[model samples]
Target: MARADALEKLRETLINRRRALVRSATGELNQLQGRSAKTGDLLDAVAESLQSELNSQLLEAESRELTAIDDALERLDQGEFGKCEACDRAIPLTRLRAVPYAKECIECHRASVKRRSHPAATINRVFDSYQRAQ
Candidate 1:
């Protein structure tokens, strides 16, 4: 398909996803707020607390995705969608379809993930260097 057509399709997908996330988040918020802390016993209270925590985590993830979707929409409007932010390369249609809000191409995204996953290693290397200098 043409580039414009592809982007339009992705835009529709993003909008639909945004709407779904909003609906889900709103429902989760209402449920979280409407739940009562008081329960019949300690076990029930613990279960309620665990459920509330899980809901909070899901809501947080949804909120982050909503922000990313909003950013992707803005990029689409600005004629910058489907381009990797890190490498200035056009992200593949397949990747875009898989992750509508992806900001980087596969290579760049993998590198970013690697970097993120090895922060402790980086820190250890730095410490080793500092120790050698001392």
Candidate 2:
């Protein structure tokens, strides 16, 4: 449950998962390509639709997980890996084991979830502000 051990486990897991994901994606891509060439119009359409949805889901999950891993690595480099983002306290080792990519401790994370349940309008406002500054 040491910080370094937690980081090491997360790093290893991310690497293995990424390798598996790449293999899975390649297999799916090859299957789709074959189906595109061999199937008739109706069958091809269905295959294409299913393939598209599968690809979307796979890519989304991969991207999200990779981002989390990368963020964790960045924190590792910063020597802030086991620290909570919200309260600026040390994140519990047990919690880190449960959620290797955790940015905040449990209480802060719950607060964040509550806040995000209500959508914010800051996206457009931030973009507008940036454009006006430009």
Candidate 3:
């Protein structure tokens, strides 16, 4: 398919996902709010609290995804969609299809993940290299 056609399809997918996330988040919030603090027993109370915590975490994740989708839509409007934020390269269509809200291409994303996973190790390596050069 043509690039424009591909982007339009991705836009539709992002919008649909955003709507679903919003609906799911709203339902979760309502369910959490409807729950009472009082329970029949300590065990029940603990279970309720755990469930609430899990629901809150899910809502948070959904909120993050919603924000990503909105950002992607904004980029689309600005004619910047499917361009990697890190490398300024055109992200592959397959990657975009799998992750409509992806901000970076696969290589950039993997590097970012590696850095995040071992910041201390990366810093140590950098320091060691600097020391060696001195």
Candidate 4:
């Protein structure tokens, strides 16, 4: 069916993207390491070190995204593609196209981002529920 075809297309896209991310991250890490070997003026050395640190952080983030892409591929193989992991609803094609590795539908994704950005509120809500039980 069309859904299956779409899922397959998305799967291919995710695989290709994962490959590109890995290649780019590898190149960045290599450049950072190689560039660190050179000695320079005090200010230049400081700046280079800072840049290397930033690149390392970015590469780490890319690694996390690579893991997500792999998980999406696995889900596609299991016939669970195109469904939100959080709510079990169908993820829109637009979202899939925008983020081929997305595991949450748009609504759930928004709620998740809100929860992450407001940990204090989440904790307070949990504490309030506990108080109601007493």
The estimated TM-scores of all candidates read 0.84, 0.66, 0.84, 0.82
The alpha-carbon lDDT assigned to residue 85 of candidate 1 equals 96
Query: Mind giving the per-residue lDDT tens digits that candidate 4 earns over 1-134?
Result: 48779889988888887787789789988979799579889999888888889888767667777777788899998999899989999998987876777788989978987878743233334324533754
> Each prediction's Cα lDDT score?
0.80, 0.65, 0.80, 0.77
Clash number for candidate 1: 0
What lDDT score goes with residue 133 in model 1? 62
Candidate 2, 71-114: lDDT as tens digits: 77788878888788999988887776555667788888779777
The per-candidate count of clashes, in order, stands at 0, 0, 0, 0
In the order shown, the candidates' Cα RMSDs to the true structure are 11.8, 11.3, 11.6, 11.5
The candidate, 3 or 4, that scores higher on TM-score is: 3
lDDT of the structure predicted as candidate 2: 0.65
Candidate 1 residue lDDT tens string, 22-115: 8988999987987794557888878878888988877876777788889999999999999999989999998887678888898997788787
Which prediction has more favorable lDDT, 2 or 3?
3
